[model samples]
Target: MTRARTLPAASHLEARLGLEMGQYSCAGRKAINEDAIGIRAPDGPLLTTKGVAAVIADGVSSAEAGREASQSCVTGFLSDYFSTPETWTVRHSVQQILTALNRWLYRSGQGLPDARRGFITTMSALVLKSQQAHLFHIGDSRIYLLRDGRLEQLTRDHTVPVGDGHRYLARALGLDIHLEADYRNLALERGDLFLLTTDGVHDVLGAAQLAELLVNAGDDLAATCRTLCDTALRAGSDDNLSCQLLRVSSLPTPEIDDVVGRLTQLRFPPPLAAGNVLDGFRIERELHASPRSQVYLVRDVQSGERFCMKTPSDNFSDDPAYIERFVLESWIGSRINSPYVARVVDPGRPRTCLYYLSEYVDGMTLAQWMREHPRPAVEEALYLVCQIARGLRALHRRETLHQDLKPDNILIDASGQVKIIDFGSCSVASIAEIATPLVRDSALGTASYAAPEYTVGRKPDPRADLFSLAVITYELLTGTAPFEGKLERCRSQRDFLATRYTPSYRINPRVPHWMDGALRKALRFHPERRHGDVSEFAHELQHPNPAYLEYHQRPLMDRKPLLAWQLIAAALAVAELVTLALLVG
Candidate 1:
């Protein structure tokens, strides 16, 4: 593979962060150079998503296909690692690609007449994502870190001493069917330097000498790599020589003020009106508007297709926290693909304003629908709730959480299809790992529909969303909230514990006893007491579970002794009044 001499300069906010890299390889007293190196510094979204990757491989001198093995390992890893799903974490993406590459190399080496002639190589890779350096290693290649003028080895040699000043590789890419690569993460700072070398370079130069040479090299990294290779060859090394140097020039500031300043720099377009055109899209009418954002019904002037364009409100233009959340909402919409979720559209032309587009749906919000229906049947409520659960499952699978789940966030189309919308409050697992100065709290979701744990500052889980779903279901059947406004009044754990759930059957006698039991279990005070998963909750709603039925069958006295005693006293007072009236007659 050909190496790129110059990478594109970082733009906008990313301009504050970049990397410098240098590499060199040569045949040192060997017939052929079997060592290979590769580096990739991507631009745009890839710079933040995949980051930069550098790899070095050393082929076994005794193998006939050693050169091919080393080249393939370096090129394949760099190419495939960038093509992985952006939603995946850095550790997951690299490990999966390495496993597949190892299997292919192992199969190609099988059935060889001599084991020494098989394809084999050692590999070490470094990936810089956000503010962390991820390292993957195998075999005898070495990786080192030079920080604060101190050099330290970060990888262990995968070799075993045999006899008489000779050591054979105990683990390599093609040596066995099962491959175990060492993986670790290190915190990166602005001036940190990383060095990657084959056995040839490290075997010759001691730690103190290598550090002194790197320090003296100053600003010229390419010359430093060339010097390291030449010094190793002159020291009587008999293997292929290779070395790579990478230095962090800067790191992106993740402070809330910085992020907000970058995002809010784009001026919001002047108040749009019908018949106005902007960025190839013609405005038809206004769909919705609020203090946070405005949604407009627009048509692509070229194709005449309708779409919904959403833009941030100027009222919050100076609020950094709100601006950051607005930008993340669009990113989340693009990554998730599901029928039950609204699709985010990419404009064929460059956007002139700070707005995003989505496929327009002629539908009403779930809140509006509930107001019209007032009392939906059990079967109808189950069907709608089940569709919402499916949408939640898609987010959970991608390690995302819809922290703001409520009737207002769901839409029902004319054809009766359900789609979840409004991701401004969602929390993404992979994005959370990135170093940022924003302090995340549990105040994102609405108070009435939000789970009790969130109000008390507990970490949210899938069960929290389930609690919101159960609240919606109960309201759909009985037109009343289960907590009777207690969730909105709660300010602490004590308030949540003091709240009690009113049976759904009491509000609407049409609700079956078993179904009420299912709702009660899903609305438990503690997350652990709720259903294990959304699917489990959906199943219980359709098929009556004996356990839920048994719990519901318990007498009113067992359920609430105080309420039962109050009712008993009222009954006795009425009976005494009747006996006195009979005596007076």
Candidate 2:
């Protein structure tokens, strides 16, 4: 339940990341040892996505091809984990890879004389991602954490004891057709040390002695591993000796200077007009130009393909945070794939300036579409909303938030297909993990459509986007912003709570009562009261939810303010007339 915590951007977080690693494996007294180890620490973007992977496998000595099994698992996991889609979460990606490796190990070893012991090995894997350590274990392999000078074992050995102090592996890779691996994630801290060992080393060296060795070994991880292994061998570890060591030196941070140092190397491109060419991209015409950026419709001279090239304005050429965000917009776009969302195009050639290319959407902005068709049917509007929800889902699943969701950011193609575009104000979870020096707003969308949580300085989530979508839907139905646009103007939780909610049905009689209930729920000022996710909101919109039947049971004042007030006025008039009659009598 205690997940990893994200540290805010600061100078301390800017410390360089270096994970010291040391591993050693030997057969000891045995002529053939079936122990294998692998470690991969990538330096590029893969480092941010896949993190660092460390694995150890101990093959069953009784199995004929135990050595092959251990080697295959170690190699397969390391290669496949990094190759997975970067959009995947650490848990989902690692589980899928390990499961596939498990199936392959199970099927491939079926040709052996005894399939039971064939290709049997214990595997323990550790992934050091942003501010966390993810672990997967099976069989007797062990993982230990050394923090604050206290060494604690993090993995449970999957073994069952037999008679006369004998034990056998109850769970191991390729031991059964079904794989049941233990997985857990823990918060990471600087200077935290991790140890992995096979039964050969652990059985010989007690935890106390091993902790002492690790302590005396100190900063020299290689020396620590060697000393531990030698000590284990000396202690009569005759079967085999294998162990791995890793220490977290630092955590990656989002220092402002870091971004400036990198952005200064890439100078901004010069002013351009139609027919001007730069880096094999011919500028056909400028599509949109703002104080922030200039979007140009460009033609790739080599492929003759057309696309949109977005370049940051030179006005902020000296700005580092803006430059970093511009670069990240392109990075976020490249990771997402959905027909409902815009696609980032790779130019195939190196660019000479700071710019990005996106697929040319042959359509108008949702705002323009709304103007052309002022009043759409309920079904039509909901259809458009469902498409946008799907697009939002794509972003949400990737751990990204479209902090800015509004009509202007959406595109409606000539074919009537909808696509949510733009990553300018989006937030990527991986990038956010790095500490930033600049102030990061919880929401960056237009105030008119931004959620109340943003106004209150609360962090935005997918539900915040849902609030924006509900605002758009309400506008489509009532031809007006909800609460006269007071929602975004809200500056405090109490302000939002005090703002009177105006149901859409009051303005548009065509809206079904049930549908309006759905809108009201999604438009709740507090995120907790809103639908848990996009799918829930979409489902309630398409179908009548009996749960929302309470919506229609409100007091007459809320149901019809004018009618209720009119009745009160009528009663007051009648009471005054009755007093006048008594006075006349």
lDDT on C-alpha atoms for all candidate structures: 0.84, 0.83
Q: Model 1 over residues 1-585: C-alpha lDDT tens digits?
A: 223233332322233455778888988898889999988888777776678899999988888778888999999999999987666678888888888888888778875777556889999999988888999999999999998899999999999999998999988887777899999998899888899999999999999989998877566787789899899888888888999999887776655555556776667777899999989899999989988899999999999999999988989766666766777787888888999888888888877778889889899999999999999887898899999988888887666789889999999999879999998889876676566665544478998999888888888888998999999999998888878977988999999888878889899898878888889989988899999988889888889898767766889798778989999999999999999999999
Model 2 misplacement above 4 A: 1-16, 26-36, 57-76, 87-123, 129-140, 145-193, 215-230, 233-241, 248-258, 435-442, 549-585
Give candidate 1's TM-score.
0.77
**Residue range 1-585, candidate 2, lDDT tens digits:** 011223222222243456778888888889988999888877666776667899999998888788999999999989999987776677777888878887888887798888886888999999987677899999999999988879999999898899899998899998888999999988888878899999888999988988887776566676677777788888888877788898877776445666467666678989989999989999999989999999999998988999999999999998776777788788889989999999998888888899999999989998988887788887888989999999999999887889788999999998878888889999766555544566544456888888887788777778999999999999887778888878766778888888877777888888988888899999888799999988889888999987556657788898779999999999999999999999999
The clash count for each model shown is 0, 3
Q: Candidate 2, residue 430: CA error in Å?
A: 1.5
Which portions of model 1 miss their true places by more than 4 Å?
1-13, 27-34, 59-70, 99-122, 157-181, 254-261, 273-282, 372-382, 396-399, 429-442, 459-485, 493-585
